[model samples]
Target: MAFPFTPSRPLWLLGCGNMAGAMLSRWLESGLDPAAVTIVDPMRTDAPEGVRLCAVPPADEPAPAALLIGIKPQIFIETAGTIDALTGPETVVISIMAGIDGATLGDRFARAGGIVRLMPNLPAALGQGASILHICRDGANAHDVADALARPLGLALWVDREALIDAGTAVSGSGPAFVYRFIDAIAKGAEKLGFAPDQAAALALATVGGAAALAAASDVSPATLADRVASPGGTTRAGLNILDADQSIDSLVARTLQAASDRAVELAEMARN
Candidate 1:
């Protein structure tokens, strides 16, 4: 679905790195006007045709209708002054920087129309990402605008509480790396079982991809699918038993997310100070 409301004023994007780049590319591909967008990134070499690229915030232009801050959280303070002039009471500030809370953003951009904290994973580059949004204000229009921006990127969801964004960071933002590690572990296991290194890696990758695709398309729970795959006394069941024994995998995953979430909180504290 398209954005419900097309921004009337210019949209300024600060720091067009990987995450921001993916989002912008998706927005442009979804028919957002390139002429209405300006990217401010010193290191970025180019932008989609018709979009303007600049090393610094524009001084001549009026305050933007929407400003997206895509810079790292650690450098936000250093970069805030440059983009401060571009925000006003009419400008919606959407930040994709992890660990930065809405309260901090609200304080930083006190005059902004609204503040939205969004967490989008690397899969966004492929338009198959999961974007979690948390807006400072309570209203349908704010959600609509954020949703519209997230739709082209991938699965878009909004949480009632801002704290949930950090939880989402643990599950989605840091999820890709965990999934990659699992895939690598699977490949290593296969290699130990006699498969060639390269062959094992390829098969492991494809298996995980296919399973994920199937799960995405299926109506039944993955548990049910696992039962179907493992008939009585089957090889799959044998392996699953080891992984499921004493809920080892479940506990490990919980701890993993907990660690990530804790770190997010630490980052938030750092940003606050």
Candidate 2:
């Protein structure tokens, strides 16, 4: 079932950038009452049809039941204090800002029920995003609330080890950009091999899309699927051999994720310090 759209609990979304905007749109499309949300974003001019959008918290507005911080980690200092209205002990504070830990959040909003750190990818809009969740040790209720909110997106998984959330961010939060780059590389490679630019791009994109669909639909593992594609002495085998012999693709991808994860950890430390 889709997540319940009960408007009993109000939601406050602190920023509406691309990732956060996708989540907000998904929630609204999932039958959540747009009226339940109030988006606070200085630069963003619009919000879902029935939701309120403002540059700052209303002077005398009632505190929301759950507050989700969607800004970048670097800007937390500028925004954290302004969220005091919902810092009551019973209010769940969910943070989507990458690299900020729950302890730091709890310190900023000490009265909150608990702090939850959520890392989600862009694909969440289609309910197919991967979400990794975690919270401070004192945040059980906060975790449940966060999971409830994230469930509208696909594949919400809890990670007790907050460090792993950084890994998740690298693999999921920044992962889409990496995937797109790989698609672009594929298209360029195809073009270099004589296909027209547009034709090469179309085939490269369709190949990725079709391959992903097959992987998702089949029970067989991707490794086995590769075997299925590469029949003995086939052209696919020749290409596979080159990739495997040099370990080029896997090594490059590993390095990419490692770099992203390290940066996330660095950001986490910066926030902690």
Candidate 3:
């Protein structure tokens, strides 16, 4: 289904980099009209076919039904004043820029109908993303509008507490890079075990992909699935034993997430200033 865009005004995207480009692609695939969207990006390298691209927000145009802030947090601060004109009392301001919380957005776009903070992961480019959103003020049908925009990208999750948006950033937003590292680690292990480099890479990627698909389809928890794989004293059991020993993997992942979450908090502070 196509996104149900407001007929009166277009959707204004303040940036069109990697994450924003991915979202636009997904929305287009969902039947969003390219003509109904306007992109204001200094670097317009990734714009899809038929979408409007502008170096700056256009002057003398109607306020957009929604304004999506898709730039980096630092860039958003630099350009916030410039794009402030794009939002109005009927516009739902949806921001995907990390580190900037709802209060900051509310303060910046005081005339906006509502403010929404969205955290979307890399997989969103492929319509397989997990988007975490926090709606600060549900004015002008903001909740439904945010849902409509997120639904086309992937799984949409609404968090009641704005702080959880940062937590989700660590888990789902930065999670893909972590998973990629794990896959590479497995590939390196395979190489050490005598597999060719190309073969190892392919095997590692396919194995992880298939395993994730299985886990998603399974009714049981992933822990149960892991147990089902290890027969007593078998090779799988041996490998599992090493991973489970002293909970090293768990501790490492915990520290990894904590670091990402902490950085997100720092960004928020920077945005506030």
TM-score of each: 0.93, 0.94, 0.97
For candidate 1, the C-alpha RMSD (Å) to the true structure equals 2.0
lDDT of 3 at 176: 95
Clashes of 1: 0
**Better model by lDDT: candidate 1 vs candidate 3:** 3
Q: At residue 84, give the lDDT of candidate 3.
A: 73
> Model 1 Cα displacement at 110 (Å)?
1.4
Candidate 2 or 1, higher lDDT: 1
lDDT of each: 0.84, 0.83, 0.88
Candidate 3: which stretches are off by over 4 Å?
A: none
The lDDT ranking, best first, is 3, 1, 2
Indicate the worst ten consecutive residues by lDDT in candidate 3. Answer: 1-10
- The stretch of ten residues in a row with the least summed lDDT in candidate 2 is 1-10
Q: Over 4 Å off in model 1, which ranges? A: 1-8, 138-141
What value does the lDDT take at residue 56 in candidate 3? 76
Q: Write the per-residue lDDT of candidate 1 for residues 70-108, one digit (tens) a residue.
A: 988988977666566677766778889889888887777
Q: Flag the better candidate by lDDT, 2 or 3.
A: 3
For lDDT, the strongest prediction is 3
Residue 133 CA error for candidate 3 (Å)?
A: 0.6
